[model samples]
Target: MGTEGGHGHAIDTSIPSAARMYDWLLGGELNFEADRKACEDLLEIAPSSRELALNNRWFLERVVRFLARERGITQFVDHGSGLPTRPNVHQVAQEVHQGARVAYIDIDPIVIAHGRTSLEVNSGTRFIEASMTDTGRIVEQASKGGFIDFGRPVAALYVSVIHCLKDREEPAAMIRRMREHLAPGSYLVICQLVSDEERVRREVTELMDQGTDGHWGRVREKHDVRRYFDGLSVLAPYLGDVTHWRPDSDLRRPQKSLEWVEFGGVARIR
Candidate 1:
């Protein structure tokens, strides 16, 4: 468990945080009453939210295991990595290759606090506090002490966090910047909240924005997420509900709801 972060901000229990809300949805106890209430409101808008979160989490694990075990990807950079959970990226990757390295990046105060406390024993992993879109600093810090080798292949994972960016924040541009830092054999694992129903998208986006005080981005359509992977070589089962993204054979996942989904897939940087 090794950890370091750029920020030392104290956790504010009065306001809602996307990371904490997500923790609450995952049945984790690192959240405050505010986050729990916010999740309750979110459930009203999208009844399948808990199911959606679980599926997205499952997708993350499935992809990480597949990349480390099957593709021989030994290093992983997890952007916007929320509160620590079971079978984290480092855990999954290390299972395949004991020396595998992982860097967890997130700007949330609570995430940084809990991460530093809980992940202090793993020497091969790091928890960095910074905006995932902060390409320059993230690239710099993740590279320190040979934490991650830019010369070697790596997996840059956005997972379900890109939706936290506003349009002006240019999530795609951030991806492009990170892609520029990876080797030809490296890969990008991305996914975000998307919906086919316009109403579902509008309402959820609005509610989250208000709940987090504009710390959230809009829910987009499938095509919107597709554009993020413009030049990357997408793996099979390209861009759809994450629930169906190469599901595990031994494990049964929850079914996807019609209103919205966490959508995206794995893509090679080349």
Candidate 2:
């Protein structure tokens, strides 16, 4: 178990990982029985877990397209990017502009394995095995490899993964650091599990914390997430449930779950 071809690492199937559980929710097979059981328990809490995952994924695709086509952003850094789902960042961006380059970062060994294999043939893309907070290493590796140019207007994405970060980890501060690293006119795409219900927040946070062996962050309120976008120019309609943020034709029907939602938006770094 080591980093080889950027895919080698010890995978402990005994515990469920947030990335693997997320893959299971999305109907992917990159998960183990532990992950499946965790999802089952998660569904009992958030009955619409699967739907929420799908909506969040759709939001990701739409935002990437907007960045590539309308915003003319050619580079992307997908922080905490999980298992390779269909229409990945590079696929969405490159579809708009074939020259688009993307660097996917994640700490999950399974994600690294799948991402490296799926992206092996794509010269314009690369995967880095590292925590999302290791911004310096990520930028250095991405720039040195020519997979991303820090000098250009790159989009740094933290979609649906911030909930995995504890407060002490300072997710907001991490975003600020990344904001400083990016060039002017760069963008930040963020969203995470947010709930208005205190019960839902507490229970889900506790459940995930236990399920992932304390590798989980607390579920936060919308205002807590809002602080992450403070001082930045939020895109049209402002920060809200991602399902309502620039939805394409395919997302005409909104998700009806009120227990929680992926809350946040895209912001431009001035």
Candidate 3:
């Protein structure tokens, strides 16, 4: 973490970060030139990269809205939260349930820096900086925050973040730990970048790894993502491309490649 001097926080421009790259993909100005260049290179290989980002964001909004409005779930925990983008989880949930409380968690210093500035003031929102691997610590901190009551059904979101984990960390195990903490009838929303085309996966993974100085994770196979939902009961539509999973019509669009897209689904703890 390289400091910009005032916020006592470091903004490292030397290594490209996924959050920054995502900001670039979404046309935000919070990223460095390295992030932009990496996004461009990724686009050259995966032309639909930007669209994929938008689609995934849409999925997040829809899931939050559903939990708040339809299911009467007022507590949300967003893990691996990226930069503070428009219509974030808190915004969407609060619209449906004004008293909805949300806790945003992320390991990146940039996320924490921006979160403190943007989210800390909201009465029902708070941001905590921590790695996804520290599920116990995350749960403990969130429990102390008073916004999220683990004793009740809480929505735990892992949207578009699991791919950041390597096999050694056992992303599935992390999910299981969170599940063990949630009350029955809770919800789990997950999605990860996936592709059936090996060449597409290899090229995108290699290019991103190089450009970001190995900060990115491998693009997984579709089935591998589905397996993450093993213990939970999947919602009616089961898992598929992120764009196709109960997507809003306005956000629905055709795919540019037959290779793959972000894939996963929502499930309930039965």
TM-score of 1: 0.95
Clashing pairs in 1: 1-119, 1-120, 1-121, 1-122
Question: Model 3: which residue pairs collide?
Answer: 2-10, 2-11
Ten contiguous residues with the weakest lDDT in model 1: 1-10
Q: In order, how many clashes per candidate?
A: 4, 0, 2
Q: Over the stretch 1-270, how does candidate 3's per-residue lDDT look in tens digits?
A: 111111124667867788888887777888898778878888887888888887788878888988788899999999888888899888999898889888888877787888889888898887877777788888888889566899999999998888777677788898999999999989999888888889888998787667656556678898788788997899968888767776666746666665658888999987
> Which residue pairs in model 2 clash with each other?
none
Q: Return the number of clashes found in candidate 2.
A: 0
* Whole-model Cα lDDT of every candidate shown, in order: 0.84, 0.85, 0.80
**Candidate 2 residues 1-270, lDDT tens each?**
001111236778888888888888888888899989988998898887888888888899999999999999999998888888888889999998998989888877888778899975798898888888878898898898566888889999999998888898898999999998899899999899899999889999999888777888888999999999999999897899998898787645467677889999999998
Instruction: List TM-scores for all candidates, in order.
Output: 0.95, 0.95, 0.93
Q: Write the per-residue lDDT of candidate 1 for residues 137-156, one digit (tens) a residue.
A: 98899899888999999999
Off by over 4 Å in 1: 1-8
Q: What is the lDDT of candidate 1?
A: 0.84
Off by over 4 Å in 3: 1-10, 249-253
